[model samples]
Target: MSTTAHSLDRLIDESVFAGRIYLDGEWIEGGGGEIASIEPATGETLAMVGVASAADVARAAEGAARAQREWAATPHPVRAGVLRRAGQLWEQHAEEIMGWNVREVGAIPPLAGFALHVTAAECYEASALPSAPLGQVLSSEEPRISLAEQVPVGVVGVISPFNVPLILGIRAVAPALALGNAVLLKPDPRTVITGGVSMVRIFEEAGLPAGLLQLVPGGAEVGEAMVSDPRVRVIAFTGSTRAGRAVGELAGRHLKRAHLELGGNSAFLVRADADVDQAVNLATWGAFLHQGQICMTVGRHIVHESLFDAYVEKLAAKAESMVVGDPAAGQVHLGPLIDEVQRDRVHTLVQDAVAQGAELRAGGTYEGLFYRPTVLANTPRDAAAYCDEVFGPVASVVSYSTDDEAVELASATDYGLSLGIVSKDALGALDLARRIPTGIVHINDQTVNDEANAPFGGTGSSGTGSRHGGVQANVDAFTETRWITLRREPGQYPL
Candidate 1:
C-alpha cells in the first residue's frame, strides 16, 4: 500500500474522478456515466466518480456469490488474523486515514483521529471472537447427543454513512470477512479517500485475498442495486431511518437478513447526584462530535428537576466555548455539518424550537458548513427538534421532576436506540435501564461509545431491532450447528 500524500490542511485531488466506483478489488469507471463529488467545507468540486448502474451491481453480486464458498470455508483464526493485521496496517497509515476523514467529511481533527483509532480497535475486536460456532456439551444417561455450530451465510453487503464513516463502514466488512463471508462495501460517497481506498490497500497489505473485500463508491443507485441483488445473503447498513426502512423493505422482498444501525436521537439524563463536569463533557461531545451526526449522540436529555437549571447553565456555557472552523484545525471543537443542506436543516430546527418556546440556551451561528454548536432547553414537548432527529450540531434539553418522568420522557420518542441514565443510586439506574425502551443504555454516563465487540443496534425507529453481534455476528453465520449422538449400546437412553 502506498502512503497517501498526507495532505492535512490542503485539498489535493490526486487525479481522482467522481463515479469512480471500486468493485471486485479494482478501481474502474461505472458501467453507466459519471457523477461529481464535492468538498463540503468549500463547496468545490472534488471529482467525478463512475456511476454504477443496476447491471454493475448485478455483476458485483455474481462475483461475490462465485467467490464466497471458499472464503466461508476458511478457518476461524485466519479470518480473525485478517482483522488484527488490518489494524496493524491501519496504525501505520493512521494519519492518512485521519486526514481524509477530517478533510472529506468535515470532522474536526481530534475527533477524526479518535474515529480512526476506534475503527482500528473495532477491526481487531471483530477478529478475536470465537471464530467457530460455540459448541454444547450435553449430559445424558445413555446415548448422548450434543451438537452446535456457526456457519457463514455468504456474501454480505455493507452500506455506511458519512458521519461515522470508518466506525460504521468497517463494522460489517471486518466481521463479515472474519466469519468467512465476502464483502462488498459501499462507503458514503464523501469518504472513499479516508477509509475507502486506504482500507482496500490495508486488507491487501494484511494478506486478505483479492476479491475477499471490495469497495464501491458512488451514490445511492449502486448501493440500492447491490441490496436488491439475490446473491447478497446479509445486508449491513448505517444511516437515516428513512434509508434503513427502504433497505429493510427491499431485503424483505427477498427474505434476506438485514442488519441496520439507523437513526438516533439519544437521551442524556442528569440525575441529582451526577457529576456536573462529566455530564457537561459528554453533552458537548454529543452536541458537536462529528458535527453531532452520530446516531447515538445524546440529542435530548431529561435532567432531574434539582439539577436542571444548573445543568443547562453549564451546558450552554460549554456550547458557547466551542471553536468552529476548518476541520483541519487541530484545536477545533466541531467541524461543519457535511454540507449546506444539512447545516440549513439544523438552522431551521434551532429557529423552530425557539419559536415554539424552547429557550435558545446557546449556539445558532453558521459559516458555510459550520453551524454553531447549540443547546436548547424548556423546549415544547411537541416541537420537531424535541421529537425528531437533528443530524447537526444541536441538542435539545427538557427537565423531569422524578425518575419515572425522566424515563417516560426519554421513551416518548419513536426512536429507541440509546439512553443515558445519570444517577448515583445503583439500584435506581439499573431499574431505569431495564425500564427504558432502548437497545443500548448508558448508566451514569453518556449514551454513546460502543466498542468493536459490543453488540450494537437500536430498537423501534432507532433501527430494525436486531443485534449486530459485532465481530462474531458474521463469523457465527459462517458455520451452522448439528446434533451428533454417541451410542453406548443400540438405543440406550435416559428417556
Candidate 2:
C-alpha cells in the first residue's frame, strides 16, 4: 500500500475493501474487470476496484428479490434498530470516512466533512421512518370499513453520481432500507470505495440481514442491467441532466417508479438594496466550494445595475484569493475537478464565454486537473457560461436594469433547481422568492444549501421528483399504498 492507502487503513477497518462486491452475506469478487481509481489531485492510481458485470448485477437483483419478503416482515422497530446502529457506526468512523472522501474524490475538508455529517444524519433520520404511521382509516358507509396502508416497493436500484457520493447514495439507500425495501447500489466508478463499499460495511456491522443491501460498482453496462431488470421496482438516481434523462426514459419504458435528482445551473440574484459584502461572501462559498462540483452551485449571478460593478470587483477578488491545489495538503479552499474531462469541459466553457465577449475578470488559469476559481463579467445571456451548467469553479456575473428582467433572466434557463435572492428587505426577498420558478429558493443566502430535514430537490430539467429528507419524503418515494375494505353485513340488493 502507498502512504495514502496506508493512512486509509488507519482511518477505517482495512477489511472493508478486501473483497470489492458485497452480495448476500458475503464479500466476493466481481465478475467484471478491474478499474483503476485515480486520485485527481496527483494523477496517481489510488486503488484498483473490481467492476461488476451484467451477471453480477443479476445476482444482486436476485438476492434482493429473494430477501425482500423476509426483510419486510421484520418488525419496524427491529429495522429502526439496525439503522440507528449504522448511524452510530458512521459517527464512530467519521474522520476515516471523510479522509476517504478527500483522497478518492478530491473533496476539500469542509465539503467532505459536511457530506459525512449529513450522511450520518440521514441514517438517524431514516431510523424514525419505520415507526411512523404508514396508513390511515377512511370514513365508509354503514357496516363497512375502509383503510389504506403503505407497503414496500420491493427492490430498489440506486445509481448515484460521483459528486457528493456518500450523502446522495445514503439519502436513497438509508430510506429504502427503513421502508423495508432491498437496495442494489451501483456507485460512481470513481468513488466506489467511499460511496458504495463503506455503506455496505456500515450496514453489515449494524446487523442488517443478509442479502438486504448489495454494493456492485461498475460502468454504464452494469447500470443498464440494474435499471432494466424486471425484479427492481424503484429507481433512485442522481447525476447529470443528460444521464438522468436516459434513466427516466428507461424507467418509463419499464413502468417503474423513478426518483431523479438531476443537474442545476442555479442563480444568485442580488437586489439593489442588498448588502454587497455579505452577498459576495456567500457567492464566493457557493461558487468555489468543492470546485463548484455541487449541482446547486451558483452558476449565474444577476445583480442590480447599481451594485453590479462593486459586486463584480468584490467577487473577482474573492475568487482570486481562493487556493486551489491538492486537498490533502491542507487549507485548500478549492480542489481539483474529479478528472481531466471535467477540467477540460469547464475550460472550454470559460474560453467560449471569453471568445463571445465576456470579460475574464479573475483566475482563469489551470495546472493539470486543478483549475483556479474563475469569474466572468459582462457575459451575454446567450454565452455558454451564463446559459448552461458549468459544473466547476466558474461564476458568471450579469447586470439587470429592472426587477422583472432580473427574475426573467434567472428563470429563463432550462433548469429550475435552486435560486438565491439577497436583499436587505426580508419581505421583499420572500416575495421575489415566491415568484422564482425553481424548486427551492434561499433568502439573503447563496444557492448552495442542503439539510437532512428540508425538501432537497429541483424542478424541470433539474429533477423529475423530489428527494426530500426525513421519513415523509422516503415514504412517498419508496413505497406504495393499498386500499382495503371490509363489509360487516350483507346488502339488501342481494339476488
lDDT of 2 by residue, 1-495 (tens): 421132334444444454357788776678986788778898787677778889999999999999989999999999999999999988888888888899889998888889988888899999999999999899976667889999999999999999889998999999999999999999999998889878887898798998999888988898889889999999999999999999889889999978989999999999999889999999998888899999999999999999999999999998888788899888888888998899999999999999999999998889999999999999988998889899999999999988788878888988999899998898888887777788888888888888877777888999985766866788998999999888877657756
Worst 10 residues of 2 by lDDT: 2-11
Model 1 CA deviation exceeding 4 Å by range? 1-19, 46-48, 129-131, 134-146, 469-495
lDDT against true structure, model 2: 0.88
lDDT of 1 by residue, 1-495 (tens): 122222343232344333555666666677767655566777766556556667877877787777778777677777778888988877877887777777778877777778878778877777775354456677765655655555566788888888878878777777777767788878776666664666776786687876777666667787778788888888888899999899999889888878888898898888888877788887777656877888988888788888888888998998888888786655777777777778788899889989989999888778777788888989998988888999887888888888788878888889999888777786788787788789898776787776766778789998877666564454543334455666656774498
lDDT of 2 at 227: 84
Q: What is the C-alpha local distance difference test score of each model? A: 0.76, 0.88
Q: Which candidate is the best by TM-score?
A: 2
Best by lDDT: 2
